[model samples]
Structures are given as C-alpha cells and as structure tokens.
Target: MPDIKDPLFQPYSLGSLQLPNRVVMPPMTRSRASQPGDVPNALMAEYYAQRASAGLIVSEGTWISPLGKGYAWTPGIHTPAQVAGWRQVTEAVHAACGRIYAQLWHVGRLSHTSLLGGQAPVSSSAIQAEGVNVFVAENDGTPGFVQASRPRALDKAEIRAIVDEYRQASRNAVAAGFDGVELHAANGYLANQFIDSNANDRTDEYGGSLENRLRFLDEVARALVEGVGDASRVGIRLAPLTTLNGCADADPETTYLAAAKLLGEIGVGYLHIAEADWDDAPLMPVAFKERLRTAFPGTLIYAGHYTAERAREAVARGWADLIGFGRPFVANPDLPERLRIGAPLNEHDRATLFGGEARGLIDYPALEAAEA
Candidate 1:
C-alpha cells in the first residue's frame, strides 16, 4: 500500500505547540450556552471533546466583555463562572487528545443596546455596522435575524478599556486550562472596526493613517501576548477581503497586507484568515494571496469552504499551512475521519445551526453508523 501520510494528516509545529496534523477546525459559533449571558456549559464541553481529532481546534468567537457580544447565546470569558465553565471544556478536549485555543473577541458596534443588557454597543466610531444579527429562531415559525444595532462612539479611554478587556480575557483563557488564545480580529468586529475607515472616522491619533488605524490591532496583540505569554501562543483571525456581510474595505489587499506585516513583525503564533467569500463565491486573487503569504512567515491557516483536496494543494503549494473547516465540522463531527478515507460528508441543516439540542448539534451520524 502506498503511504497515505499527507501534509494535512502529518504532524507539524505551530510556534511551540506540536499538533497531530495540518488540518484545523476553525472557530464555530454554537449558541448552546446559558441565556442572559452565554456562559459555557457541559453541552459545549461534550461538543468540543467529540471533535478533538482535528490538529487544532480554535474555539468559537467568545466575547471578552459584556458589550463585546453582538448575538445572544454566545459564550463569554469576562466572568469567573465563564472561566470555570471553559476549564471543563478544555479538560474534556485535553482528555480526548485535542489541543484547543480560546478565540477572544469583541463585537464592537455589531451589537445594539437592546442586546447588551440595555447598554449601547461600543465601537471605534458611532457609525452603525451594516449587517443583520444572527439569532436562534424563537418559537414563532418565521426566520428571525435582528436588524443592525445602534452603536455609540467610543472615546480614547473607552478604546483603551477595550484593549484591556481583551488582555484580561486572554488571562481568563489561560486560567481556564487552555493551551493558548487567538484574537478575534475578523468578521467586522472591534479590530475590524478600527481597520475599516467607513466605521472609523475619529480625529484622534488612532485614526487617519493606516498605522493609526492598526494601532488597536497592534495594542491588542501586545496585550494578548502579555496575557498569554509569547507571541507564539497568541494567534489572530482576519477576514481579509470579505465582501459579503457588509464588510468592504477601501483597499483590502493593501490594508490586510500592511496588517499582516505588522502581525509578522509582532511575532504572532499564527494567522487564521477567512479566505475571500468563504462560500460558493470567488477564490482569492493570486496577486493578493501571494503578498499575504510572503509577509506572513509564520503559520498560515485558511478558512471558509476549504475542501480536503484544496487543503492539500494549499499546504503543498505553500499557500496555507493548514485549512480550516467550518460548516463541514459542524455537520460532520468526525470530519477528519471522513476526509481521510474520502467519505461523504453530512449536509448541515441551517435551521439547527445556532441553538438546539442533540438533534443537529451532536446527532449527526458518523461513518460507523452509516456502515452499520
């Protein structure tokens, strides 16, 4: 038999951590946490533990502070209870021979006061982010997604506070028995708010030049590094050039490359990038991908609609160090096993994506079930 060991299934080193393979399970939002605030629970622990076969599991975008959450039912790391809850999750994943990292996040202006315990969501500027908030369907039969939330302009002090929140959140992640943390800089969130000139119109030093715009990202990176040890332990997620979801940067490639170079200089552990479109949309422009890959010398993980074959090509061609599977992992808990043998993937049910019980969350039958 020909040797089946490929880069995707081969062990590699990311910073100081050694992983079982180059295949990664990107952070996915499973809104199964407790209400009021999305505190972690036993359900979440079991969910992650079941999928521990991946090389690395970057946990879902966990809110760093109360105002950091845009949607309801997402987990947070600001409170002691939340940290304790995450400890259970990490313990379970560890027992399953999995390595996990908490992806720290802040939604910025993506949220409304109505959702943040009646406190307006804060952002770099007062501009409203143009997008719909995803929420779990209520008892009503209609599909419901909350409208764009009102945002309050943040002052210099508030901006500093935001950075501090991330730092503390990183600390919480470390205390929770996790291996590391990945800053949620993607998907039009806080750091994205600063990077997007449309949302950032401040007259202060934190605005105008690209350097000023990326200051928040750099500061957060520094804080995260301090909270989580070296830069190798702190990764960052970037939705570079995502046109969907109302995210349109003036010059995405230029902006993201500049940011990538900065991250490289800062010595981040790895960069988790959500590729252009991420769906049945456009593939990344060859010119842009080359620039980012060149600037980012460390680990590169690509997400959004990454097929097993494409993942192998990416790693082989040096386009990406690892490929992140989002929906596939959601529908097929043992996605790695399926990909290993070219097995069929279970289609994901959109209705049960957010919050639900074992029905769609954990009930997806494995290959063994199918064989039986």
Candidate 2:
C-alpha cells in the first residue's frame, strides 16, 4: 500500500488549481520537436502523457519567436502551427488528468548566428556570453554545440517588441489549452541577461541600478499577466545564484528578493527557484530562502538535485510548497509513485538526453510494467 502520510502526497491548492501532490515535473528541454518547424508532435505528446502523474508539469522551455530560439529542435509557442501542435500535447495530458504550464522562453545572447539566420543575437548589452555553448545545426545538418555569437544590445523599440512577443506567447499558451504559463526568467536567458549585473552593462533605463535592471522583468511580467488575463495563471522562474550561460548578479539575494516582491505585488500565481545544481556549486543560504518566502506570498517551488527525503524536509521546514524533479522524471514516468513507495528509480541515459527518437524519450517502463 502507498504511504498516504507522505508530505509529498498531500494535496495543495495553487491559485484555482488543486494539485494531487507536491511533486512537480520541472521543465526539461528534450530537443525532440519535429524538425523544419520546431513543432511539438505525437512523440512529444506521448512523452508528457506518460509522465502525467506529476502533480504539475512545466513543459520544456518554448521560444516565443524565431529570434528567441537558442537550441536546435526545441518547440516554439509563437505561430498557429506551434499552437495547434501544443494543443495535442495538452489534450493528451488532460486526458490523463494532468495539469501543465507552458514555459515561455527567449535565450537572448545565448544563441548562435546560425540559429538566428546570420543575425546577431540580442541582449541588454552588446556582450557575448563566455564559457557557454548553444546547440545548433552545422553546415552538413549535424547538430552540435557552438560558442554563442556576439549579441547587439536591443534598443528601446526592439525591447518593447520582444515584450509584446512574450505577451502574445502567453495568450497562445492559453489558447492551446495550457493550464497556465511560466515565464522563463531564469537560466541566464533573456530576462536574466537584463537582471544580472555582469550581463547587463547598458546605462539605459533597462540597466544599471537594481530597480533599473529589473525594469525589463517587470514589464515582461506585467505583459504576461495582461496577456493571460489572470495573474493567477502566470508564474516566473528565477535563478539568483546560478551563473549559467555566463550571467550572474552582484548580490543574488537582494536582486531576487526585489524580483520576488515585485512579482508578489503583481500577484503572479507562484515563484519557481532554480537552485545551483552543478557539482561544487554554492548552496543557497537558508536565510535567503526564508527571506524569499516572506517576500513572495505565493506558492514557492525549488528544483535541483533534490531527493525525496530532502523534498519532504523542505516542505516540513516551510521552505518550499512544492518540489520539482528534473532528470528523475526523465527516466521514471511514475516518479511520484516511486518516491511514495520507496521504489528504485531508473537511471536516465545521458547520451540520449538531447534530440533523439522515442528510445530515450518515452520508452521508460512504469512500475507495473517493470514488475510484470
């Protein structure tokens, strides 16, 4: 019998949505979208439906426009074809009684010219990201990682245009039957390029002072809220400490606390924090977590290298309202049940993690099938 007493199994209400458990399948870029159009397809739908047991599922980071794309073979939420493609995925998840949120993404300077039709990527400033490589298709159509291209700073008008794209993406997500939309503000993406001090050196209103640096985020969040027509259907992800893709803030706590407070005032439904998960990464101080909890009066989710025991402890300590399992969900479709009954998890195949066919995408067996 399952342990009903597990905290992860407790039902929680997130705005108007009631989650069956506290386990979340955080967004993971599978890079398996159909080629030539970057559209979600039947294989992707089956992959998500197989893992519909998660209390909440945040779909892979989806570009809001062709310019927002950084990686090869990822899905987009910008066009009619993309929207229709996602509708199939959402319908499949809903059929299995799962709730999903589309993660709106823009990679900013973390993109290569090949992916941008030879156009330089855009960022808060004309700075190129170092020590990070983005996936792209080479001349022979072979996909590989390449250094990010130099980016041109966006002028005021272009900035507004991208913001408008995000707004439309949010509406598209709803039209496609997503339960809500999550702004991909974390992972050193476009929003992070504007928020992080090291990345945004522009002296314009979108850069410099902390509030100034956050202006872009604020505008984008408001746009998302307005586009969704409900603040309760919008969430923002932030990575205060992570320097992923060469973006870092002078003081993550202060920057993120202010970001959280701003989102709170805007009344976004929740805040998802992506902790530094890399080996030897700095641990996010407990004090900062507590302060964030106080600043944002909404559902809080933390993801990164969390075990079931740690997840329960975080909930018990009031540090997190929910937990997101990343790679675990990749290999174990029934991750929640496995964690609930202390079942061993299947190891994910790292080589097959990126663009691939159904082998590593949806071939993982459920507990019942494994036992049988």
Candidate 3:
C-alpha cells in the first residue's frame, strides 16, 4: 500500500500557508502586459483564474524596477498602477478560492537597448549572454522573439539599489493582495547572474568568492522575509542546472548547493528549483536533487518536463514536496482534475507561447469546459 491515496491530491503546508493540493501551477513566462510596463491584461487574469484548482499558483516573472524589464511587455510591480492592476488579478484568483504568489524579477543583462526603455541592460560583469530572449517583438506584424544585446556591468551603488527594489517589490505584492512573494533567482536573471561565476566576474562583494557572490541573494531573501514576516508568505525560484547561452562555472553543483543551503537557512518559505533544462538533460544527477531535499530542509518544489506519474514517484520518494508543471499547465487549465481522472491532455503550441492573442494563453480547454 503506497499510501494508496494519490500523493498528488494531498493537502500540504509550507510554514503557515495551507495548500489545498500538492499540484502547483508553476511560473511560466508569457511576457504579455498592458502598455507603460506595469499593468496586467484581462486575459492573463482569466487564464490564471481558470487554473485555480491547483494547490498554488505562481505568477509570471514581474520586474521590480524599470531596468528589470529585460524583455518588453512583461508585468511590473514598481508603480501604483501596477499594484492596482495586480489587485484585480489577486481578487479574481481569490474569488476562485485559490492562493497566488507573485514572482519578483530583475532580468539583468538579458535585454537589448530597445527593451530597456532606450538604455543598456545591466549585468554582474561586462559580459553578454550568447542566447536569445523570448519576448514579443514589438512593431512586427506578428508576435515572436529576438536576440538580446550585449550588456554593461552594474556598479556597486546600482547593485544596492537593485536590492532595495526587491524589498519594495515584496511589500508591493503583499499590498496587491497576493498571499506571498517569490524571488526569481533562476533562469539567468539578476540573482542567477550573481550565482553563476561565468556571468559574474566582478571583484565587488557580489562576485568572486562563493560567500561574496551569494551575499546579494541572501540579502534579497532576508529582505523579502522581512517584508512579509511569515515564512509561508515567501518562496523563491532557482534555475540551478542551466548552462544556457554559454554560461558555465568551475563547479555548478557546489555553487548551487551553497545557495540552496543559504535559502534553507533564511527560513522564507519553500525553494522551487528548475530540476533540469528539459527531459533530455537534468542539471545535477537525481541523487544530487534528492540530497538537496535534506539540504533545503523546507518544502522543495521540482519542475522541468515532469509527468504526473513521475511527479507522484518524486513525491512518494521524498525527492520533492510539490511539483511545478510548465508545458502541461500551458495546455491544460483544469490540470488537477485531468490528472485525478487520468484524462488525456491537450498538447501545448510552441507558436503561441510568448505573445499571442488568446490561442494558447487562455484557450486551453479544461475537461468540463470542453464537455460543456
């Protein structure tokens, strides 16, 4: 008897927040927003609201400052209008009896001059990522992504300002009616830049030695916890296994484990990590992620090409407490219901992922919606 009860359907706790089920609506980058960089559209609200059956819903990456907008059209939390806009989003999710967390982001150096409000993108060092940013190319006939520009490194004063932005963003998320705030420390963003030695070549406190490099993220975690007070009201996302855009280090596993242990020590909610880049390549070995379960010593969320069967297995074996679904969630709004009944899922469309009208964003047919 393997707890015969579906591990995926069980209720769990991350400190003070009580989740209704273990299935999580993980953060997916849609890059859709209203003009002026601070407003979320009605479609995004409906899209997230319809999928509220999951235990938790983490929002798309939201910039905490103007420079944070490494890509165009992504939502932000730096203005009054943005807060009010998010208020509507939170109200809708709560009306559906769902809990939501906003992911605070700073896309350091992942932008071009056009995307940064006519300014250059900032980075940990004067290095550029050898990859493309997937945002809606404005002025083009149809929506699509493009390559980013080389970026300049941030000075110490600017670095301090960025930390303040995260602190303020955490406060703004609480005021906007979210249950918690998620620091976006993954996916080659600002915090991840500091974590990756290749991306971070500064001799300042935010670079060099592991402790020095990790200081910025630690400060962010502490500040976010201070903003919300309760550990349950705080969570973080980290993409530890990514070697994308030619970003590499001497030893990523050691670097990530140190970062994970630091977050666990900070005591601000759960640690959500990108378990692997995809099905073909998982960043550390399965054994390494399992070891991180103990290293974190808090609720651990694992995402990256995980199937329902695999998720259940991970939960049963204690490799992860919650499972964050990316692609499956993209094509299935009523994902929990579908999984419970072993229903067939709608395949996600690659064309409509980034910036589209409503084809793939909100048109994912739930079982009941389709039946009706």
Q: Where does model 1 exceed 4 Å of error?
A: 1-5, 136-143, 278-280
- Ranked by lDDT from best down, the candidates are 2, 1, 3
TM-score, cand. 1 vs. native: 0.95
lDDT of each: 0.83, 0.94, 0.83
- TM-score (all chains, Cα) for each model: 0.95, 0.98, 0.95
- Candidate 3 local lDDT, 152-179, one digit each (tens): 8888898888888888999999999999
In model 1, the Cα lDDT at residue 195 comes to 85
Candidate 2, 28-99: lDDT as tens digits: 999999877999999999999999989999999999998999999999999899999999999999999999
Error of 1 at 178 (Å): 1.3
Candidate 2 lands at a TM-score of 0.98
Question: Residue 161 lDDT in model 3?
Answer: 84
Candidate 3 lowest-lDDT run of ten: 134-143
Q: Model 1 has how many clashing residue pairs?
A: 0
